[model samples]
Target: MEMSELTALLTREGLALLDETGSVESSADVARSVSRLRAAGHSPDLVSAVVGQARLRVKARPKFGEFADRMLFTRAGLEQATRLSVATMHAIRLRRAGITHVADLGCGIGGDSLAFAGAGLAVDAVDADEVTSAIAAYNLAPFPDASVRQGTAETSLPDEGAVWLDPARRTAGHSETTRTSAADWSPSLDWCFEVAQAHPAGIKLGPGLDRDLIPDDVEAQWVSADGSVVELVLWSGELARAGIRRSALVMQAGETHEITAAADADDEPVRPLGAYLHEPDGAVIRARLIGEVARMLEAGMVDEQIAYLTGDAALTSPFVQSFRVRETMPAHVKTINQALRAHGIGRLEIKKRGMDIDPAAFRKKLSLKGSAAATLILTRTTSGRVAILADRV
Candidate 1:
């Protein structure tokens, strides 16, 4: 939003009108609201700001929950913002470490700052973008201890308190942005590393970040929400847990589970296929702690080069999705399709690892005519490629 529009939206009249209009779900609602507000003789800037924010609030619900109703957002800021649940975990870590104040550097719309403030910690939130800083200030207004400022993270770093850095990994834009190399990130990764080394800090990064870039002194944690790997966070100094170099945090079904190790765990020896095949959560696979999970399930690697684990025991855990083996067949489409047809299977779920074929394209080539359903796992062993038919456990 422009400065003029933000100024207008901060007014009593604009806020009242926005609250009255409520959440906008579609372009039709936007048009109707615009027409009504225009007819009421509201300024075009105020109308645009209110309508735009109403739409954003709807999109923000999944991340912010009910708090989104009274909050403000910009498109890109909302997109990059951390989810409330995940941010709360970060806040908990700091609080547990005896940190009383947090400097949320590169705080986009104050997502993490909200969590920090809500946890009863003083928050100094900073963002480089002017409009986003203003929006963050508004969102954080309810917390007396939270403050938002517009400035580069380098200049705004607080002399006291733990720091939370989520450097801008994209080029600046309100609606659309282009990804940047780590070297080009605002408050460059090198600078972030130096600051982290000096203070109790947490650096939030993309889940796909290169392991080689991770500092040795920090604890690297991979977090997954539901089934998706969401982020990699590096905790430094007092925030870093002792003897824990790698950690996987899984948040699913309102429960959180963590597996940590001093370093990447060794891969289990590959063996023949077992009765059950387990697919580890992405966070587990990313943290390279599959060996730890393999021991828990009494499972062995389906292939040394792949992440799939297999065992005969009927076991399941939140760290992995288990599938009961039905049959094994040659990896050829004709052989699999005939087997599938013989089983009277019409619905199929395709899973793959260590294979080049596209599951979607492969599914199209099959003649699915029966009523039964099965999952097809396409993978390779030391011998050759094979297909495993299975059912979800």
Candidate 2:
């Protein structure tokens, strides 16, 4: 979003028109609104900004819920904003730690700041981007205790208070931007680490961050929401839990389950394929807590290097998606197709690990033409690569 468009949209007529425009879910709706507004003598900049924001509000609903209606957003800002549910958890953690005021450095679109204020904590949010800081202030307008400013993370640091650091991981732009490497990240990971070490802080990082780069003393927690691993956070000082080096928090169906260990748990020994196969959640795998989950299910690894777990028990947990084995055969596509056809399997869900096959490409090679549906698990074992036909339990 350009500064001129933002200037136009912050006025009375522009905001009124945005509310009157209602929901714009399609390009056709945008076109109609643009034409209608243009015909009615509205400026092109105003029309563009209002219609563009309407479309963004529709897209932002999944992350921000009803709050997206009154809030403002830039294209890149909306994409990088944290989900409200996850941000609420962070706020709750700070509140529980007896922190009353927080300085949110590198606060993009003020997603976390909104949660902090909603949780009854005072917020001082700062973003280097001018438009993003403006939108953040508008979004946080309802909370008298929250404030937003335009400044770099370094210059905006407060003398005292807990800190929430979210270094910008993308290039400088409000509309379209590419990811910046760890070295190029604003406020740099090294500087963020120094801040965390000096004060009680929570540093949010990408889930796929290299494990070796993590500090030894901070508590590392990987979080997954509704089956997708979202973020990894490093906690320091009072925020860090004692004796817990790694943890996985899984949120699904409105319920949260967490597993914590002093360190990465040891993997279970590889064993023969059992009656049931369990696929661990991404959070569990990222946190390297699969052994803890395996112990809970009385399961063992399917391969020494594979993440798939096998067990004779038909047990299931929130940590894994379990399947009951029906048959096992060679991994060859022709033989697997023949077995699938013989079993009258029509619809198939292909899952693969420890193999190079692309599920989409391999699915095209299958001769599926029956009434039954099953899951085809393609993985490698101690013996060899095999295809196990199973049904979700």
Candidate 3:
């Protein structure tokens, strides 16, 4: 966003106008809102920024909830910001570790800072972008303990005993550029790790971070919020666990579930298909904790590399979604469609692993007409690609 646009957005007039405009659900709605605002004599830049932010607020509802309506956001910042629920976990961890003050380096729009301050920790939140920093300052206005600074991470590092760093994983501004690999990070992953060693620190990273590059001594925690694996965090100093080096944390609704291990867990033995199947949660798979989930279910993997698990007896756990095998169908698309028809199944939920077919396109080809709703698991076994018709258990 331009400096003038941000300045305009902060005006009493702009705030009143934005509040009145609210969220527009579609392009036509947005156009109408924009036209009304423009015809009412608002500046072009002000209207554009307000409209863009309104759309972003709508997109941010799932992550920010009611706060999205009040909070300002850049597209990339909204996408990269930690959900408030997940940020609460980070705050609790820091508090438990006896951290009273934290330096939130590379803080984007003060998402994590809000949680940290809400948990009674003092936060010095820093962002490199001026516009984002300004928005963050406004968003964090409610918490006096939180201070947002428009500066680089290095310069804004406060003299706090604890720290949290979320390095920029994208290019400048609200661009959609993905900063692949550790070196692309704004503060660099190596620098973040270095700081973590000296203080009670947590560094947020991509869930797809290379396991090989992870330091052996730190606690690497992969978190999935509402079924989506959002981030992997590396903890060090007092925040790190003594024996545990890896963890899978799952957050859904308001509940949090976690499983920790000493290292990347070993895979369970592969076994043939059984009466029941278990699909491990994304966090479990990302943390390589599928073996741990398998043990909990008294099951073995269907394939060594695949995360799918099978056992004769039904088992219930939050770590894995359980399903009862209804029938085995041929892997071919035509045969699978015929099998679905024979079973009187419609409204199918297609789940695929180790397969190349597009579920939506394939579903369209099937022309499903039955009244039944069932899950179809398209995956590969040692015998090759197979389809398993199943019911949620």
Candidate 4:
């Protein structure tokens, strides 16, 4: 939103109207609300901006929970902003490192800064965009210890006890951001690493960042929330573990699971598909800790390079979703179609790895017609491409 509209939104009338209107759940809902506001003689810009923010608040419920109502967000800022739960973890980590003050470099909308302040730390939050920095200031106003600055990180580095950096990975506006390569990341990774070396720091990065570029002495942690992989973070100095170097943090509901290894493990031996198929959690896979899960379940990889595992027995754990293998089928879509028809399978949940195929397009070609439902796993063995039909266990 433009700064002028934001200024209007902060006025007594605009805020009262925005609260009175509550959340706009959809585009049609926003349109209807806008029409009603215009009929009431509200300015067009005020109506548009407040309505847009209301819609964003509704969309942001999953990330910020009740706090979303009190927060302002840019479309791009919300996309890359850390969820409150995850940010709390970062704060706890910082506090444990004896950090009483934190410099949140590139603090988009001050999401992490909010968490740090709540954790009882004084914060200096910086954002390059003026409007974003202003919104961050408003959000952080409740925390007297937290302050925001509008400027580039290179120009406005906070001299403080510790630092947290979240480089902007997108090159476009919040509404339509384009993911750029690591080289294009703002407050570049090289610069972040340099900063980390000199300060007790943590840097947030994309989960898919190249492992080779990661520094040798920091703790690299990949975190996932509610089954979706989120950002990776590198911790250094006091924030870094003494010996641990890699970790995966899985957060679901009120439960949190974690796995760690000092270094990558050797690949498990490839074996034929077993009675059960296990798909490791995304966090585990991202951290290269699949072997740990395999060992826990007494399973082996279906292919030495594939993340899919096979076990003869059931596993009771959160690290992987186990499926009972119903049958093995040919990888050919036509043959699979016939097999599905014979098995009375009308519904299919498709999963693929180590294979080049679109699950949605292939599902359409099946012309599915049956009373039964099942999951289809398409992957490769050392031998060749294979299909394993299974049921969620």
The TM-scores, one per candidate, come to: 0.97, 0.98, 0.96, 0.95
Pairs that collide, model 1:
none
Q: Please give the range of 10 consecutive residues that has the lowest summed lDDT in model 2.
A: 153-162
Model 1 spans with C-alpha error above 4 angstroms: none
lDDT of 4 by residue, 1-393 (tens): 888888888888988888888989988998899999999999988998789889988988898999999888888788788999999999999999889999998999989999999999999999998888988998899999999989888776667689899988888565787889888889888999999998899999989998999989999999998988898999999999887888999998779888888977555778888899999888888889888888888889998778998879777468888899988877987888888988999889999998989998888888578889999999986557988888998
lDDT of 3 at 335: 87
Cα lDDT tens digits for candidate 1, 113-143: 9999999999999999999999999999999
For candidate 3, lDDT tens digit of each residue in 284-352?
Answer: 999998988888889999988788999998786988889999988678878887888898887899998
Instruction: List clashing residue pairs in candidate 3.
Output: none
Q: What is the C-alpha lDDT of each candidate?
A: 0.94, 0.93, 0.87, 0.88
Which of candidates 1 and 3 reaches a greater TM-score?
Answer: 1
- Measured with C-alpha atoms, the lDDT of residue 278 in candidate 3 is 92
- Which is the better candidate, 1 or 3, if ranked by lDDT? 1
**Taking the candidates one at a time, how many backbone clashes does each contain?**
0, 0, 0, 2
Q: How does model 4 score by TM-score?
A: 0.95
